[model samples]
Target: MTPQPFVAMKNIEKSFNGVPVLKSVTLEVEEGEIHALLGENGAGKSTLMNILGGVHQPDNGTILINGEEAKMADPRVSQEHGISFIHQELNMVSDLKVYENMFLGSELRNKFGFLAVEEMCRQTHEILAELGVNINPKEYVRNLATSYKQLIEISKALLHKSRLIIMDEPTTSLAEHEVNRLFELMKNLKKTGVSIIYISHKLKEIQAVCDRYTVLRDGQLVKTGMVENEDLETITKMMVGKAISQERFMHEHPFGETAMEVSGLTSTGHFKDIDFTVRKGEIVGFTGLAGDGRTELFESLFGFRKKYAGEVKINGQVVKIDHPRKALQAGIGYVPKDRKENAIIKDLSVIHNMSLSSMGNFERSGFIQDKKEREKFDVYKKALNIKVHNPRITIDKLSGGNQQKVIIAKWLEAETDILIFDNPTQGIDVGAKQEIYQQIIALSRLGKAIIILSSEAPEVLRICHTINVMYHGEITARFTGEGASEEEIMHYATGSKREGIAIG
Candidate 1:
């Protein structure tokens, strides 16, 4: 008898707006196997996962469970098939308690037919305990840290009796220790025969947790085989169909006076006594595994955090920036991590959004707009290769990568001396990542002081003039050219006690 695979999909075909997303892509996941799905952004990796999770129905495909055909008409239907998905965007009610959030749809009913609060809390605690997750199930999700929220989302999959778990960029927002805990849990679950399909851009993660992999390129199958002996170079080659190089890194020009300075930068519990300096023309990359207060640090620096207590200095002049508007007026440009939330305006015209920050420069007599505004917009639009129907069209219509370029364009128009890029390449395609990387170095070459907060290790190594490692609101270690070691950095990042790590 032929032993059936635990899950299989044959000849999957899907498209969006007549563009082929998945073309004749077939995948199989044996029982208890961790299948690593690989692809550049928009290479049909997301589409395939979406179909499996009932988020989208394939135009043509056959899904089989234990060799028997199955129907996945909707997310609920997919859930019924014992498939639970943890998306990069955690969908949890912030106001609700963890226990209530866990028992959300299936609240335990007491004998009187009321909500069984005690029973639900007991079950949530049991689930958390079994997974070795140290969390109070009754605490409000908003009160818990972002890492704890991530664990809750993953645990929800287990509570649903899901045999096939699909995690998409699960650690994109987790701290170092939290990521290790998550990885350990993944191994434990796999030992118990639960299949995990992890999708991410972190190559090291795939190499560590995945035993087998399937590579996708331009909406087609490039390779599918066991991950054993499959190095990052090989996986990358299949995904991009080319060699990945570090040619974008350039020599640092002589830094001038301090372009920006922060003295005793603190935001209560988030970050404290954060002293840093960015010299003119220097690209200082502030890096840590996500949730190391990198984002919060920048937010405070840009005056987005009201409770922040810090002194900002530009060109050796101390200034108080009490709001984002004040920060922009002080010649500071900040490009946020979440493109949708912080950068682009969906309904606005591309030209309009690009010129928004510098609108006053484009206005005359406090009423009339000038052609110079459009010329400014076209300069960045063409330089960044922003794809759109027209400059007058909406900004949100572009792809993920294109949208990010628009965000940068908005800040570039402001002509700020100090640029704050918080995970600028997060969720963008590989090709787009390369493009943005080149732009970062370009900005530095133009004598713009750039500060980058990134989770991807390769990105920091490739562009930063110097690197600083942060842990629990403290600068743990600093690395200079040729001295930056990934292993040593990870050791301090993951809370190791050993010392002797160097600082640039």
Candidate 2:
């Protein structure tokens, strides 16, 4: 006879503002198993997880823990029931120390009701050691790297003695080695009978770590089965309801004269002697591991870093870009890496955010042309397939993928000849990524010089015409993207190998 599931969510249904987001979805998690929840953006994955974590209530559903009906009225009750959630944006106070964050709300006290610092540090050290993390328990969280911060989150979950943990995009900020370490720790946790609900867009990682998988599409469960029995393509098809092509997505386009050229672009300790050129109708990609300075280099190029020393030429004419305004005037547009923090204004309406940079063109006799602005936005909305009920609402209410599309629409309306996209598809879903890629290709075809900066080598290989690898602020290798290998790129990115180039 088969054993009962450790946790089961049956016939879950949720609606937002009278619009159904989840429809009769069911999920089951067995003890000591790593189960993956797979889906594209806006497919009801977050809503379902929120219901399990007690952040929201399902309109129609039943939750059972070990065949016993469970009521998750609040987060405290869920925690008491041995459930923990580690969100993508980690929930840790940066000002607090490591041990302080671990025992933030649930503190230890002595018989006299005094704070117990020694006991808390001891427990924190024990948990960190178990996870192969060696650091001072008193270290400030703000000073630590992203991977260490992620480790601290996992340690906190373990400290709660949680039987089940829900990890959302846990490896988004981790490096390759750090991801491997996390997978190892997950295996150890599984052996100890801790169930994990893994959610990520990286299908390769899902296949590597998860034992069982469930795919959700358009608020409905499409399929659930063992990961070992299905291929990545099959799983992707189930999620998006179509087969996605893996070949290069760039279409035939004629390359034009150079649009932007940089020489001796040095930011002193960040990057050194960076030399590259992007031509109109060309797509160039810069890729490296963490701390390789790819993002820093692009930030400087876009005039966000004023201390950088570089000779920049736009359309074969030398220009000085000391501020973002200057970069815009020079016909260079940049889509920053972090959309929520860097690109989107939380309080601004979606239409206003799209027309923010181009407001001058939308002004008529000292009056803003709201209708004209929205008419332009409607064109992009249709072309990009952006889903939004009301354009007057705040941009933050949309999904990450849609928010990114709005940002892209903003830059496209600016009509810049040189465009730089840093981590173009950083937090986006699989289907949205392909759409963005197609948009980039379309921009290139329209005689725009496109530059893509990403850490994922596969992303660059699939869409870029030229790929440059950087290590320690230096360009280590350059591939034509005709037949570039991730292994070769990683070797240079990790500083294991370098190609000597003469500095001018």
Candidate 3:
């Protein structure tokens, strides 16, 4: 007799607006195992998960749980079936308190049916403590960092006590230590016979924690097997259909005169004494662990934060920019980190979002030129390989990676002389990352100054011509990108070493 898998979806077929998204894809998962769902952006991984999560229904499929056919009619039904989904874009209400967000739909009540605020707070604290996170349960969620918000979302899932949890890009905003703690908790949950369907583009993390793997590409199943049986290159090839090289990018064109230079740029309590120069035709990267203040420094430079003590020289002329409009007027364009919160206007159409920042480019005599706007968008869509069936659809309907591409296109259309991308590929896949890198490189070659801020050292190493490591709100070291190794970068990033030397 054959043992039945815990969950099985056989011959799943789905389409949206007559476009096939999942073509007879099949998947099976066993009890107490971490199953990885791997694929590039717009590869139907999310659509398949949405079907299982009850956000969408498959046109044709049979889902069996514990050898019994089950129908997930809605999100609540999926939760009732012991399934919990933590979506990639966070669902936290910024105005709510930590405990309130944690107990949103499933609030505790006393005998009289009054809200048991104290009891809810206590449970919230306990669950957060389990993840090595400590915060006042009454604190507003908007006051917390993105990393803490992500932890709160995870704790909310644990509160449900679900038999199966689907985590999508769960660690995208977490620090190294936080990621480690979460992995430990995941292993503990597995010991208690809880199953997890993990979806992430970080292949290394998948190899570390996942038991089995499934690959999907272009709305179809391509491979499925044990994680231990395949190397990263082979797995990457399955997801992207090509090899992705991790070598440093070589620049043939020489850097022009300094486009932007900063000295003693200090934002009180955020960053201090940040000094660097970005030349036309050069790509400079700033990298560090969480709380290292690289993001804050760049935010100040981009005029998102006004009260900063600094001297900023653009083309050797000192400029004061205390607002985003001023930053744009100064020929600076910024692609912020959090896409859902900071980058896109969810209700706007994809083409509108692309042209929102540079409305002048699509306007003629105080009127929007629809045909001109679409023609310009079509160029970027093809260049960036954006996977959108119709430009008229709302921006929120696109995948995270594709949303990021749209944001990038928005800046490119703005035609800024200097561009700043903070965590540019935060939720992007390996293949899409390569395309973005090539685009950045091409931009630099055309005499645009580029600044990249990323927590991943390897990312800066792979693309930048100059690298700066930050620790405790200061620049600890600077290295020519080609000569610096990841180990050396980590040494400064971790506050273990400091040096002020220029080398090529």
- Lowest lDDT 10-mer window, candidate 3? 495-504
Model 1: per-residue Cα lDDT over 22-117, one tens digit each: 899999988788889888755777678888888889999899988989878899888888899997666789899999889778788988999988
Model 1 / residue 353 / CA error / Å: 6.8
Higher-ranked by lDDT: 2 or 3 = 3
> In candidate 3, what are the lDDT values of residues 230-320, reduced to their tens digit?
9999999999999988777787689999999999999889998878899999999999998999888887887888999979999999999
True lDDT of residue 29, candidate 1: 89
Candidate number with the higher TM-score (1 or 3) = 3
What lDDT score is found at residue 55 in candidate 2? 89
Which pairs of residues collide in model 3?
A: none
Question: Which has the greatest TM-score?
Answer: 3
Q: Per TM-score, what order, best first?
A: 3, 2, 1
lDDT of 2 at 381: 83
> Model 1: clashing residue pairs?
none
What lDDT score goes with residue 277 in model 3? 94
- Residue 404 local lDDT, model 3: 83
Worst 10 residues of 2 by lDDT: 495-504
Candidates ranked by lDDT: 3, 2, 1
TM-score of 2: 0.91
Highest lDDT model number: 3
